[model samples]
Target: MRSPLLGVWERLRQGSTSFLVDASLGALLAGWAVVDTLAEPALAPAACLPAAVASGSVALRTRAPMAMAVLASVGFLGYGLAPGTSTPLWSFVTILVVAFAVGAQLRGRRRWAAMSVLLLVTYAVQILDAHRSPGELTWGEVFLTPAVLVLGPALAGWLLQRARRQAVDLRRLAAELETERGRYAAAAAEAERSRIARELHDVISHSVSVMVVQAGAAEQLLPPGSPAREQIRAVRNTGKEALAELRRQLGLLGTGGDPAPLPGLDDLPQLARATGATLTSEGVPAGDTSPGLGLTAYRVVQEALTNASRYAAGASVRIRVVHRGDELELDVANDAGRPADQRGSGRGLAGMRERVELYGGSLDAGPREGGWRVHAWLPRRSGSPR
Candidate 1:
């Protein structure tokens, strides 16, 4: 639907002040032609004088388009007084250009009124001068010429306004796209950070729980001269194991290497043994659980054991891992015999709940029958959990 020539013309119009320049040059050419072809010697100077003035008025088209229009109208009337002059016809082109510019640049009702007056005056003067018969100034000709002049500019201005509105809409769409992209990036970053926090908590809490259990056992069993040497050795071995696990977990955060091995369901028994908590496993085989689910299961148990050892040290703990049908379930319970001073501020329980919820699972932690219990169920996929 687009023409290359029209595009080129519009580009030229935009790039230079040539519309008025071309109009002025055209007026001068028409005047010269009229002087040579239509004007007699006596009227030639007068016939060409209005054309010269109309040509010069083009310079003020943008600055004072209404004034230029009035000047061109006057030129047309002056040229009409000269005998055998046809140069006044060309002045109408200048008057049209000035009216269009005025309508396009000025705002509101005033601009339309000014354009209407200009067109009406130009049409009246041309009709009165050009017609010879008494009935030559018909209503049809009077209305038609001015309508053509006014509507041409009004149509151009309308198209220009539409194009401007489209450009503004495009800019707003681009800004909204940028804003949405930024929000997506921020959400992605927050998700990654939460994953890392969960991983760190699992690794450190598991190691610390093992250390606490071994240290407590060593303290209780090491009495003078009653087979205390083996208990001392076991404590030393447990301490070394805890330290080694801590180092391995920290090394996974290295920048230039593959990630360290992550603990999964296979490591749950060892985890339970280290914490001195009784562990029971049931339902589907360990191989059936996905890597992510296994990792989450191990961490939940690890957090549970750490909480038990810290706040309920001497209490017996029971830990269970069950894969029932399509879901994995975990439960840890320990007698809450600690004095009020030894209880936690509930941050660990809240953290556990948050971690479970991230994988589309649900967790419950509270006191149960003179003991503390933490239970969680994680789904095989995101949509449903048990």
Candidate 2:
């Protein structure tokens, strides 16, 4: 309700300002004519009335500028023809005002035509008046008055029109900039939400997989005082480890808490052992790799194993990371005999692709032969070999 009321008020204010600007110009011209004409004693009282009325017509100049101009010209002519009327200087002021208004409103050829007609008519009136009076028409008075009266006003109007057009263009450009800003803001917000969702998914999925695996192992090894007691204790330790990691990760997402250190490529071996997946590292030592490359390597393996355990329950998976020149390459493959419908929806693969691409890297994942494969390559640093 408040917004609607404000909109109405803004519209009203704009309309009022436009009206005042247009009407004020008209009123000024009329007032000038009144002051100039009243100064001459030779002009009759009736002649002064037409000159005064011509000034008021300026109020309608913007709306019906051409018509108001015609009206003012006709009034000036009428005043000139009146008996006892001296040279009507005030009449010229109204004609000039009308000439300027016409040029401002009319465009191109029409504007030139209006200006030409105004000059011709005003000069003709001056010439006829001089012919009837005792004074002879001098070149300066004949040419200068009409030029000043018509061209001066027309030039002013043309400039004002140009200024108004530039202002309108500026407003349109500002609106477009504002719209683009809003769209970018919305896109940023959506991206942040997506990152949070991915983080939550990773934490939850990893915790659940560890819990299920340990529970299954404990159940299978449960017996009466057998050597399997050691295996059961191992299961308890695994469960506790999984729970502690889950709590730490979840706390990072809580209010006013610092984020836990992210599990990077260096943590891949621990991740594999925790998930009960037979894992082997065949590349350079993790400590020798850069932090960025290690992080990417870790996330890829983590997402891959999570998907394999969830979808391909009993499948043996092979994970490999290789440092070749200035590029780090990764490949995770699983030969778990599972149908397409049994596999994860590939969101982890998509997230891996996004993460790799941020570092100007490439990723590929698809069904190959009888199994699925995920591969990625990330540049080591600036100016590193591709």
RMSD of each: 16.6, 15.2
Cα distance off (Å), candidate 2, residue 315: 46
Location of the lowest summed lDDT over 10 successive residues in candidate 1: 251-260
lDDT of 1 by residue, 195-238 (tens): 56455545555546666677767766667666666676677677
Model 2 alpha-carbon drift over 4 Å, by segment:
1-41, 83-89, 105-113, 133-136, 199-204, 223-283, 286-386
Best lDDT among the predictions, by candidate number:
2
In model 2, where is the ten-residue run with the lowest total lDDT? 253-262
lDDT of 2 by residue, 284-326 (tens): 5433444445666778778878777776777778887776666
**Per-candidate count of clashing residue pairs (backbone under 3 Å):** 0, 3
Off by over 4 Å in 1: 1-49, 53-89, 130-137, 191-386
